[model samples]
Target: MLRNSKSGYGWIAITFHWTMALLIIGMLSLGLYMHQLPQTEPATFQLFQLHKSIGFVVLTLAVLRLFWRLINPSPRLPDGMPPLEKAAAHLGHAGLYALIFALPVTGWFMVSASPWGIPTILFNVLPVPHLHVPAALGSQEEAESFFKLLHEYGAYLLIALITVHVAAALKHHFISRDDTLNRMISAAPGKTDN
Candidate 1:
């Protein structure tokens, strides 16, 4: 039950999916809240640190999840699904994974290029290295602005993808009455294709 089956997802896949989903949602909300605070507020710094810490955690998890996914292939789509639908599912998953990697990296670059030059002490415990951005590219302000825009727009794209992902899952479960959602929720070994 730990490995994926042709018919359904296993415990590991389900755990990774749900855990990352929850963390991403939390990170998005936190990012929005932190963005609204004035730079001078003491709480703003604390929140930014928390956001960066969690972003690093998400980045690590995303790498692990992608590795696991490569080793364990996803469950096959239910029979009778249109070819277009299957293709859309694949594209949606790819987009999500890309965003998962991108959002954190952009955030890290944004911090590294910060005009303030503040160190990122993750969770107030361990120090994380800042990414090296070449001085020749532009001013620190310019680099920060570029990465900040990327990070923000990337998050919005992620939100849009998540909405489509959820709606599709609901459609599969309710409209199609398929095992797509059930496979993720249940640990029971699915029926094997002979």
Candidate 2:
């Protein structure tokens, strides 16, 4: 099925989940590598542009994914799941979605307020315009720095949440021996593992 069913995720949701996961991993790795580079180099500038382009792609996909989730509810959790675990799952997912949205917005705001005057050329084709910043922000540099901190911290928090998510998934698969992970991976709608 193309859409989510009560038994498990559909093709679209699985595609979105795995694709975003891969892109996020790449972006995070590239970001850490770029951070250590000498910023003044022409190559460093190119790297920053690449990072910004990927960030926009992530933001776009996140918007689509959120919209899809709104229309298609996720399958119910394992029958034996405890209330605490369910709460953690809900909060963890919310945190993930928040970071997925926040990181890009903050990065865009940071670039928009940057005094460096660099333009974001998406994939070397599309031109992305900066947001119109308010005058009350005082200096462009100050605004950029503030949003930069938000973006940076947001990335760290995202990494932590992903770690927890993966660990929980693995626990469900191995220790719990439930179909919790399998439903997202591949499972018939509403089927039980016996």
Candidate 3:
């Protein structure tokens, strides 16, 4: 059950999918909460550091997940699914992967461009190098603003995609009475017939 079959996902894929989903949700919530904290609050800096550490972890996992996906093809969609639905599923997955990658990179850039010049100490242990931004980009404030916008807006889009993804999975499971969601949720041994 460690390797994927045509009808269902393997343990590895299920683990990666659920783990990343939880981490992404946690990161989004943490980001929103941290933003609301007053700058002078003692917890604000700690929250930012934690957020950055988690973001780095997400980025690393995203890369590994992408590699795993390339090497191991996904389970086939339930039979009778429309071609358009299949295409949407593919594009939605691609967008999720793209956001997973882009969010961290943009966050790194935003921190690097920050006029405050705070060092990104991963987990308060290792220092992560910052992305180098050209000085010709007007000013540090301008660069930070640009990256901030990208990071914030990208998060909104990711949330929307996740919402749709969840709704579609639910629809497949309930309305369609398909095995789409169960395939990822369960790993019980069974024939490759859905």
Query: What C-alpha lDDT values do all the predictions have?
Result: 0.91, 0.89, 0.91
What local lDDT does model 3 show for residue 90? 89
Prediction-by-prediction clash tally: 0, 1, 0
Per-residue accuracy of model 2 over 128-186 as CA lDDT, tens digit each: 99988777877999888888889889999999999999999999889999877887776
Off by over 4 Å in 1: 190-194
The 10-residue segment of model 3 with minimum total lDDT is 185-194
> How does model 2 score by TM-score?
0.95
Residue-by-residue lDDT tens digits, candidate 1, 1-194: 89887787889989999999999999999999888889788889888889999999999999999999999977888889999999999999999999999999999999999989999998999999999997875999999999999999999999999999999999988998877888888868654342
- RMSD list, candidates in order: 1.4, 1.6, 1.4
- Candidate 2: misplaced stretches above 4 Å? 187-194
Evaluated against the true structure, the overall lDDT of model 3 is 0.91
lDDT (Cα, 0-100) at 70 in candidate 3: 87
State residue 16's C-alpha deviation in candidate 1, in Å.
0.6
Off by over 4 Å in 3: 189-194
Give the clashing residue pairs of candidate 3, or none: none
* TM value for model 1: 0.96
